[model samples]
Target: MTETIIPGTYIDVRAEGLISAGRIATGVLGIVGTASNGPVGQPVTLALPSQARTRFGLADDPRNPTDGANPLTLVRAVELAYANGASTVVAVRVAGTGKTSASYTLRNDSGQQIAALTTRVPGSWGNAVEVSLQDSEEDCLVERENVESPFNGVRYAPVVPSPRTRVRVVRGATGQAEGFDVVYRRLQSEEQVRPTAAGRFFLDATPVEAGVPAARISVRKPGGVLVDYTGDAIVYETGVPAAGTVRIDPASGELTFAAEEVPAAGAQVTATYGVGHALPTTGQVLLTTWSGDLDFADGEAPVQGDTVEVTYLLDRDSCVQVTLTNAGTVERFVGPDADFLSARINAASQLVSAEPDDLLGNQRPVNDEGLMGSGSNVHGADGANAGRDEYAAGLAALENQLVNIVVLAGQHATTHGDVLAAHLALTANSEHERIGVIGAAGSSVEDINAHGMADGRVVVVAPGIRYPDGITLASGHTAAAVAGLVASVSPQTSLTNKPLNIPDVDQDFNRGQQAQLIGGNVLTIVRKGGFRVLRGVTSEGEGMPYSAIPTRRIVDYARYGVRSAADPYIGRLNNVRVRDALKSSLDGFLTRMVDEEALTGYELDVFADRSQEIRGEVSVVMTLQPTFSIEFVLVTMFLR
Candidate 1:
């Protein structure tokens, strides 16, 4: 049995039958509007409601119709988006002309400029921002200093101590207040008073013309932050080995030093880099160059020209004390720039803050040779240039982005050109899978119908929504509200028969108003306790594919399902096995949708004809029966 034949030796194999795909969330909302704060024309993803309040500064209150801070439309819309179950939102703040951030520069005891701080964005909100820096109490003990390794030429310490302790480097002397603090995982004992005596790591070391360079080395810190030797990733700290003495070769990732200013024998040489955002408020500070090297004994020394790594950590020893002076009074806000740093001194308080950035300027100093580009903060001006063009640009920013619903909060679709731009964006070559919701402020049924936006991609609401605060905003303001209601429904669920019973909706449509809204294809708040969609028709006439919201949604879902399912089989062969696998996957997806009640039934055919099969084209044909929502019911009652 062992020498001749093994009849029973076999391996069990499993054949894949069907591959199911998880449903993608087509519920990400995109809103474009003006704000009192935040980066202008930049897309910021909002995960929580508080981020909108904090970053965008949407906390201002307007007294009447013509308040200067009238961007509250975007604010309320963002609030509704979260309240109505929207999880992720992309908010773009479009700034007008001449918008500039407020800025202030600080000077040290010797009249030397220390740090320049500016607001995060261009707006009037920056005018109230105030910033101050002081020494942090957070500090670490210099656990074991070494000057042996060539990586750290002067006085270098390891990235992390063997005993595991905290270490922070203050910009000035220890315990000195009013000085910008610098925190690091490792400590530098003393600065190299003489550059000629200190060994320099050549950033532009000559390549050996073959294999990887022998002079190649990596500078790193704790938490896996590797100093980028290739690009302009490393910024030298102020003072020490002056600029131009060290050079970086982006192509080969090399760091060479001038021949005369090489590190002393057994000296550890290293550099430092910063990382974080540059935000200015009341209590904030920035970090400069920070690095650490190693020292080894006789046998511990490695081969010359070999790679070496330096590591360190940065920690806050104490808080910065900031005194903000707006108008006349001086208010003090103390602690780190993080909102959660202290419950008493949070971001909501009158005092503002400036967040730290390690990699400021990325070696692009404003004044000197060793200054960082990101270190200085400059408040920009918010001119009157912010308008429809800016709004259109903001909408353009959402092109090809994964967004399902779009809310043009402040722009009235009846008159504003921004609304037209938004509609055109949906049908652009980008083919964004989204629906736009816009409100028409104070416009009558005749006016809305005259605009003639027959596309089902956008919906216009009329009769402006009224709030309980004795203020009735324009009809266009309700777009965010409608979007929230639509978002509350599941992607698999249809909104054809859905009723929007949102609180704080003071205005309701009467019988005549409802008829007018239906005739004009406008959405309105029904008077019967909650709001009900009177008709499912889009801008197009009845019986069209996009007529019913459910019809459009299910079609989108089907398209999404098929595209997501078939993307994997693109490069595969068009043989029988591949065709069968694709058919099974597609069939399995449709079967699940049917089982979930999203579809009544669906027929999916992969490689339906021989002609398509020969051209290496996988022809997919799907005949779908959408799950219709019941808007009308008729019953005959027999007196029994």
Candidate 2:
């Protein structure tokens, strides 16, 4: 496969509320929720509600889905936040420690596993993934000309038969042969043609090998040739067939001619002819890939047309392809077969990872489901598994993010108030200054008041909100809605009568109940014409400074702006010149804030002592007078 451009995790800056050029993002919300899929303990930024399903995956249990279940918590919470009015969200997905990944095994023809595919991250959503493999082969042909056969020397053919008969003849008297008036006798002997062990049919050029026996053979051909009787004018048997013809007996060493072709009666004749025998054919080798031969025991093995054809299965290369499907989204990966398939899938597949079994001989994975691969749906993911530790890990992951508001989805803030409170305090001390929106969802007003959360950084709301379907959710979900509302508007804007965009609440408070909830420092929402926040207040008790939501946010915003203004002068000289320039920058930013009405008035002082200047410290202190929304209006009337 070619190189793939992996999609990035961060959302587009244009879609988000962040401005990298020294401006703060005041509308970003950070949330933690349990999910069925996605990298746990990592923060992922996204703007649209649809992006949540694509990045974190859909429900774990597709057959039975729930808004409160872990499989649906993250997605539902993000959708709710967006529905309220959040433009950007930094969401972190978390699961329990004992989470598992969905996996499948692939095997070869021998029933041994060749490779395996697994989910990229641990969760039950990966169970939807499936796999398939295909075969790739080529043809192979073998010739049988020189192949060694098992029956090489045992099978042969005979050129000459046994018990052959031949007649002998006498030579002339003038020939100095041993027998001038030789006795005429018929000779009989066996001249067999045997094959060698290596399937050779011919014998060596020896005296007795070619049927020329070394016996009492006095009238043999001189030098094994008959050349016109070798100057013996009266030669008969020694003459070539051009002058006279003769036949030789294989055993008796005698020569005879046809009656019409015999020499003259008084001429000298010589018995110079010899008999020869032909060899037999034998079986030979065929091939290494295929080895067999024709039955040559009954007759001579044919030597003219002894070719054989062989065909066999050839071990060839293969290609393996894998597919990962989840929530209607599909990703396909391809690579060479066997163990090499794992590398390509791991590098390119965003939905699932892969592993190969090198010890199983790297056999090509078969296409059969039962023989090669399987899909499992045994991973666990439930919202209850995420304890406080998991949420803490999620919070840690979002610590570096530039978020304005934080919220917990589908969970009660009262259950984990200590952890959330500690996190917000730490973040505020570190200058991040993000406020958390929490709610005692599903609790009575008395229970909410009973729970003590006096931290000014946290905005606690009471009595969960209800949906259009008549289902009332917990306060934590309402907290998510409130967070979205907070992020949509400016920090200085009051949330006293802002529309929460909700259908209704679980219980609308009466005047006394509202007074009790407000007195207990809970940001209570009531239904008038539509759902709107009754009064915005922190958990901080009555008459406490910084108890208003907007007041806290405004200070945080100004602190961020002031820091942004002064951060550029850190490395410069710590003398009066640099201090004056830094003060001027702060004045310019605070004046804009005053003009925007976030502040009523302010004071500025930038100074450093001789010892402080040596240590490169430039301290700037500001007296900020924040603007507050009017809550009461009493008219003075006189008798006219």
Candidate 3:
């Protein structure tokens, strides 16, 4: 497939071949919940925990309590996710009722409407944003002066022009009061420097770009044709006795040659190189910020002619300078205008404007007088339909994206059926293999069983764990630790025996809690060592297949590998050649799994039915035999 840039003045281009086959990224996770601040409904991928704090402001607000079952719970869960071992996280902030963004309006000198500037997204976080402008320092105007005669006895004075020109600062002289080399242009005529047998000449100006030469050489050979060297093919060779070529460093503008490379005794060599004359560095000037008639002077302050006025804005990054020369005596408005600041921000921002793109010109309006507003509460939808309907839409947005695990910040009182529905939707109904870690609020094992959540795809845990921090994180928080523990090892690694990263709880489970754990619900209890998972069981009950986390993990790995291996052959023909190729690819992938001891064996059945092939259907049925994790050990010791 070919890639095309969207219709715009500027576009970023990337090659298609760089897109590789999709492999299940074990450490990548998807989290959905309400946040104090962040883009609502948008899936923002964050690489570092610091980025999460910056993008979705920290939840440590004194205004709100740190109770785990509230909006702030999402923040703690994300922090825990990163703390454990998630390398990349795709956090989607779900916004409910009464949330808005803060904004301001900007106007021009005539009191005419310019544009409006708003926060990157909806949240109270935008209230902290402040906008201001500062003028560029060291800006001045320099006029070129025409001298009466040659300052020195240089023959090619006007032919190459004087090496330097004196100019007067016209405006914007608000900088240090010292001489500066502002503009350095190529010399008018090449300086006639005496060349050594071998030496180097540093040209005044660095070439505008690479691979393009800006200097030329003319040699008048005694009793021979005058030779000229210019452009890329131009070369300077050493005298016939010791022949070698002189070279120019394009970037530094330095010319080098060996001593023996000097011209023969009888030859006269003249070099023509580019030069630059700069304005004062301290009291600098902008060439475009002037109006009326212009004149160049030597050491004279040339007077400005009768004209209204002029102003300019320079974008140092893009080198785009905008100058407005007044038409009449109308008042002029300058400083970081709306459009200038808008272009600067929009150039690197993903935030969208509240107004239509067409109505807002290249620049968005900034209203200094406008009040920051538009934040609201999203909890109005709570306790209505179990919050499942709200989070369902959120999960729908992440359909095509690859997310190995999905966790819902079950801070609010969500119905058991709704939690079960979210789990089934994430794993069973979805085309991708995803495991869901959900929270069961009560201590009764029957509470979990009654929810009908006994599916291999879901892991239900009970009553929250108290973190070392003062806040008591919800049961859903355990999923972060669980996901981290699972993602810490490779797909081939046995997960059953692997101990969890210390959860740091203070007490062991009571008799009733131990009874609940044995019945299949995952729980965290303080053992002799530290806080460890009592069981790795999924929501799956006694009689079902794939009851433990390891079994489910093995199936996920096998399915993920099979799909990844078969992705490359998607559009090939259904004939024996393509089928055999498919089988070979699967065989190789399965062989690695067997070698890693993740699987005992695997069988692959490629598309072979003629009737199915007529409909252009390519199918592959992979039967996997997985190596189960050792969860129980039976031994008897006899005393003689």
Candidate 4:
């Protein structure tokens, strides 16, 4: 409704007619079981039959240790589920406790660990993963030059690094050098100043550091000693000093000499300070704590052709590949650097996740180490040892998925009825309508009757399925096969007399036993003509109203469709007109179902009373008659 206070004519276009139902899934199946690999308690959708081996490990993996007796339950179940026409499957790997992934450590040439590798998914299959290391081919080059000097012996300044580690000092002028006895090493940041004062007391320099000790400050005046002296006799006097004493004021950069012994005007005074490390005149080469230079103790030129070798870390561009192999499945990760290898492998490799340690200097692994470990086992990693908790948790993972059918692979409902009851309750509670397929307790009629489950959401199958070996019988997997079979067809298609592509049924049931199994509400499969279904009935007995599998499935499908179709109309105008449009949408859906033969007939009405409309409620009342499967035929023929 639009507000039209002063409007001439307001046209309101209702979009209720445009509301339509969305596509719904009818054949998705959820299966939970134990596997040798794959993440536990997470749903993984599998489409290819070969994905069973790659994701969950091969059933016949020789490293399974007890493959003769125990088998990987998930892989076989998935393989058989796909074998029985299940195109889409949501698989969950449930496991017992104590499950751990196999680990491998990569080391450099010095046996220092550089990277730690673990299986991508936790399981025993990761123990078969292998990794190898190789050295890089790139070499470290040298001679990025530092400092250059000459043997002038005029006190050239303490050497500071000038992009060269070695100071090249040639014999420019072969002369005697000063400070021959004192072995001085000129470090970094040393400045040499030759002051020509022109006048008597003032030096023409700017901002000399105030009051530094004479040791760091080397003032080589005429006939002045350059040894380490601790006395302040040269700097204490004011203006002028007594005879044979010199007074210097660093703030003014002026020197006051003794009045009687004043030097000639414009005398030369060499003041070298800020030696930093306090050494002699040289270029910045031989680094003592990243500072100063080469040997100038004797003022000798450094020997020519004497190369000082400096080392650095090189970028090893060698080929390094890590191979993760388990159950004949191999994933190789190739990179030159450890960090690169780790990033690539962790992002791409499905086998293992890697943690690379880029140590100080960004070092690379240099050694060749191979065959990290063989196949080891984790809890529930083998064929056996799955309990109810793991199964329940795995089923919980699939609760939010759009699965129409489900099966506890390799688990029997006769003993695990609680788990099956939970499965059935999910169907009854959630918006998603689903049914579970379970195998009978045994092939015996008494066993089938004693295994009483009164829920129509549960379908039971008898006699189990025979393995390809034609010897061993997996009774629990029979339910998985039936679930797949149910998922392969539409909800209206009955499972009766359908030919299954399995090798064979575990046991053959006679007509009497088949009748008893059907009456006991168990879906029975026999080898009448290439292993066909005998009945499509739920666990509820034949006398029950919802016992027929097609009846329950059709009802579930209709409920799902109606909910899907009408849910779009929520919060819309709950008046007679929109309610009728909603009714038409639902009616169209049901008519399509009836045309498709999913229902024999359906009576539907969408209505909202004045009180309901006031409460913003539009209710739908439906009475659907589902099409039933034909189970029996009788003919009394006279003499023809």
Model 3, span 437-532: residue lDDT tens: 666555444553344466777776555656555545556666666666655566545444345554554335676766656575453433545455
Can you tell me which runs of candidate 4 are displaced by over 4 Å? 1-11, 61-69, 107-115, 137-314, 317-349, 355-366, 375-384
Q: Rank order by TM-score, top first?
A: 4, 2, 1, 3
Report RMSD for candidate 4: 17.7
The C-alpha local distance difference test score for the whole of candidate 3 amounts to: 0.52
Clashes of each: 64, 8, 31, 12
- Cα RMSD to the true fold for all candidates: 18.8, 24.7, 21.0, 17.7
Model 2 steric clash pairs = 147-285, 147-286, 147-287, 148-285, 149-285, 234-268, 236-269, 441-475
| TM-scores vs. true structure, each candidate | 0.59, 0.66, 0.57, 0.67
Candidate 1, lDDT over the whole model: 0.54
What digit string (tens of lDDT, one per residue) describes model 1 on residues 1-640?
Answer: 1443566766534233445566766678888776666777678899887988777765344353122545445566788678767788898877766576665544434444434444545666666654444554443222222223353332321233332422222222233322112232223222222223343343222221212112222433344444323223232322333333445443342345445544445444453322222322222222222333223333433344433322222233323444555445465544332221223233434434333333331111122221111235454344323566777777878776777778776567656534554555564435456677777655555665554556666776655656566665665556676677676675456554456545544455567866776767666655454665565555544655676666666666777777777877777667778888888888988887899787999877777467766777987888989887776789999997
Candidate 1 RMSD to the correct structure: 18.8
Per-residue alpha-carbon lDDT of candidate 2 for residues 1-640, written as tens digits (9 for 90 to 100) = 3344786554422211221126678989998987877888888999898899888776334224432334346666777788889999999987776567766777777777777676778766665565556543332111122313332321111111112211111122322212011111111222222333542222121112112222111222324442342222322232243434344433433344445544333233332222332332232221111111223323432233232222222223324455556567666554345555676677677776667886863556777432112334244333336878988888888777898898877666668777788889889888788988877744566887765788888888767767666566667778888888999988888888788876678887889988888888888888877888888888877788878988999999998998888777767667786688788788888888889899999999999999999998978899999988887688899988
**CA lDDT of every candidate:** 0.54, 0.62, 0.52, 0.65
Which candidate number has the best TM-score? 4
Residue 348, candidate 1: alpha-carbon lDDT: 37
Q: Positional deviation of 448 in candidate 4, in angstroms? A: 4.1
